[model samples]
Target: MRSIWAATAMTVLLAAGAAACDSSSAGPAPAGGLAGSTASSSPSATPDLEAGEELARGLDVPWGLAFLPGGDALIAERDSGRILRLRPGGGTPEQVRTVPGVAARGEGGLLGIAVSPTFSSDNLVYAYLTADADNRIIRFRLDGGDPETVFDGIASAGFHNGGRIAFGPDGMLYAGTGDAGETSTSQDPASPNGKILRLTPEGKPAPGNPTTGSPVYSLGHRNVQGLAWDADGRLFATEFGQNELDEVNLIQPGRNYGWPEVEGDGDTAGGRYTGPLVTWPVREASPSGLAISGGTAYIAALRGERLWTLPLNGDTAGEPAARLQDRYGRLRTVQVAPDGALWLTTSNTDGRGDIREGDDRILRFPAR
Candidate 1:
């Protein structure tokens, strides 16, 4: 019961005091004090799924989810800085642009969306936002115009603005920050706020980072939303837990995921953290966006609406199976769609769940 749980009153999970304790209560979560072990929401042996369709709907708060190489996919609307482009068989999603000065407030706007693994010819595309003051990472081109600041100040708070951004597997560009609530800026390494950055795609600093020109790479985190890359590349992350566990790390670089002072797997009696390839129970799992194909690594549960698959053995991890629990409720972000299916997003409209009425969708499972 020690390892941090009262840090300035447990914040982050889209802060604002956990979105005002997530409206009223998302229930069931509290097993924190973890650092490992807790993958058995029952029903093992894998196989389980009979439906999944939505494709794309009204989409109000849909935050980040890149995947384009013809199959089309590039969504982001965390409060409407817009950036649609779903396409694939469903048609009608196409908005294609809109980023200018996005400051959309609370849990910040236009979060995560990457697609520039050369992006077919550098037509680029990258964003991780919350502007009006800070928390940046831009790069655009998909039809629109303007947007070229590769990295900016960071530290956007309405509640810990750590927006997730991905593009790893050596291609660099991995962001994941938050500490805007200032918990000592996650141990300030000259402050990049909570940290987990690695650039180069013009953002500079990426060449086996660990301080050379600095892009920090790894250093105590508190709100890293997700960044997958497994299949031997090993580098998973999905942190955001303060009042009782909620993590899923596996990152390496300058290592030191002990935030404010450690959350789930700490106390060798004195300081030193990094223990999570597992942990949930911050009201079930406020864990957001995270995906890995075939060998499993799903995890997209906002207050545990479900989609926690885990089964990756190699760098270690196995025993987790929750798949679509509350059906299609919260669960924001999860990709791997280029035909190989498995795309999810539906944050119940973001004011916090039960919205329905085309509330927020983009479901579609069946990942080989």
Candidate 2:
């Protein structure tokens, strides 16, 4: 689906974003490596496989997951564009509402979900999906009412429509978008595709953006599928790379991550694009959704069919370890619940991989 370089930069950026922002503002941060660039050599500890438990099943190609404050989970179906709500204790999923204007061709459809931080008051939910002409992000009121479109007008294609949304610590909305299957768009600052976008609750550009209040935070990404923020307010993202390098990158406002120019950690022709903090071979990690907590970042792998654990020390990401490899086929999305547990979804019905009947399910793991 994505190039190896995109994957690596995605992971590194996600960790950086979480480690660099403030809990109250979600504003941009100074560009710098975490902890003076002293790379930590500690490897990820072996995960206790028995700790992960399946929480729900019968999901049709679930792609995105968002947790409500009351411990319920919202799940998105890629093909049907239906959003389902699952209560704790595991019962039948209730279809909340179907998203409108979704183009479910190739790797596009209902992709990412994020609830407003002030959900108790706002009752707002945001989603990123592929539209008929492009990829778009929209916010809807989820208080048992009709869905409303808040923002739209992103680029899309048959593949590489980076679709992930998250509310920053500042209560603003941040979206990760793909380059719409085109390599050059990643480097085009004018294009909304292949960039991390910062927007207010009403879909306007957040205050203090890179440009004079422009929505594009940073450019030069192929397909970004995950976003997260740590306790210190830093931001991180996961991206799918070209054939060779998949990336995890630390995201800085207005910084460029060389996508078509460079793959993995290397210099590019169009100036020095930032390299990934952590790079993985494409075969090992076609990482998607990412979650940061307890000084670690969790990445869900699609082609690799595993969960990768990366220990974090400030902005630097330590070596990563693969967990549950081959145990589940094509892990798609990962989210950190409000109670600090990790919720993951499987993507067996996406048509690109093996569709195991009842293989697409939700699993929860205790965050260590």
Candidate 3:
């Protein structure tokens, strides 16, 4: 069956207007904030969305998407292990490179892609993939060379293999990993699984990390596939819950986000676990890729098949509004293009949903 609902952005925006105005629905304040400061009382305004156009069609389980300096995007296919490049205007995508030894099993495969922030000088493209032995991050150049392993040895499984990596404003590489179905790993400081790891470009633990010589930046995430930094340089992540709540968390270094121990705003009787800024029923928001623009976060939903927009004021987030509901089947990744357009990918061909004429496609929309 089709995953997303077929509704226009304006229609959903109008439908959610009432709910968006209600400050009570903004959900919990999450954990950490400036002392004695109150959350913004005014609701966040709805995004001005324009008609979307398909950028490319017929992708096979496209997972990771990154943009180069020239306005072209490099996308990764989860099962195919191929990297394809396409421009803003529609055309057949070109295969730039194919990663070798990629184990495309279950949720494992080639996942996230990132261009080195210093790409002008380094010409490096990074990828997070499930290799034969483990889930690892590797960097390679489009010009052709053996991919160099930046980091490795996270347990790999058919499911819960979180694979998203991005370079933080601090110039440190941040990776989100899953527990690989091993729940205990979420809370284990020694294990890289179920944690957001901070590492130097060469893959050593970043300086001033939460723990001395440890890459674990935050613990207790089930599966984190989306990472973005706001204008203020605060980190935000999208996490998948186990049949309960899906989360958009305001991430802080060294903070513990209750994963196996709790889901959503659960039983934080003590101040040990940080709560999510926003939570949605799992069916409504299997949120994956996230991008923030104009003080708003645009999240791509998988099972929910919609794009969720939440306004950000300071550290507090306003109520979330769903746009383009069911218009696309199974959204996977969303990124802000260099020209400020929002680029999205579909996951209908990723072993789920009803495939359409353009089963797996890349879409472009105006940035708000």
Largest lDDT belongs to which candidate? 3
lDDT of each: 0.74, 0.77, 0.83
Candidate 3 backbone collisions, by pair: 4-326, 5-325, 5-326
Which of the numbered candidates is closest to the native, going by highest TM-score? Answer: 3
TM-score of each: 0.32, 0.84, 0.87
Which ranking of candidates, highest TM-score first?
A: 3, 2, 1
lDDT of 1: 0.74
Of the candidates numbered 1 and 2, which has the greater TM-score value? 2
Q: In model 2, where do residues sit more than 4 Å from their true spots?
A: 1-49, 268-271
List, residue by residue over 166-228, the lDDT tens digit for candidate 2.
889888889999888777878887778889999988888889999875889988898899898
State the lDDT of candidate 1 residue by residue for 157-179, as single tens digits. Answer: 88767788888878888898888
RMSD of each: 20.5, 12.8, 13.3
Candidate 3, 1-368: lDDT as tens digits: 12232232234334443221122212111111111221111113222455576666666788999999987888898987878777666554656677887999999999999989999888999999999999999998777777899999999999999999999999999999999999999999999999999999889999999899999999999999999999899999999999889999999999999889999889875989999999999999899999988788999999999999999987899999999899888999998887677888999888878788756788877544
Instruction: State candidate 2's TM-score.
Output: 0.84
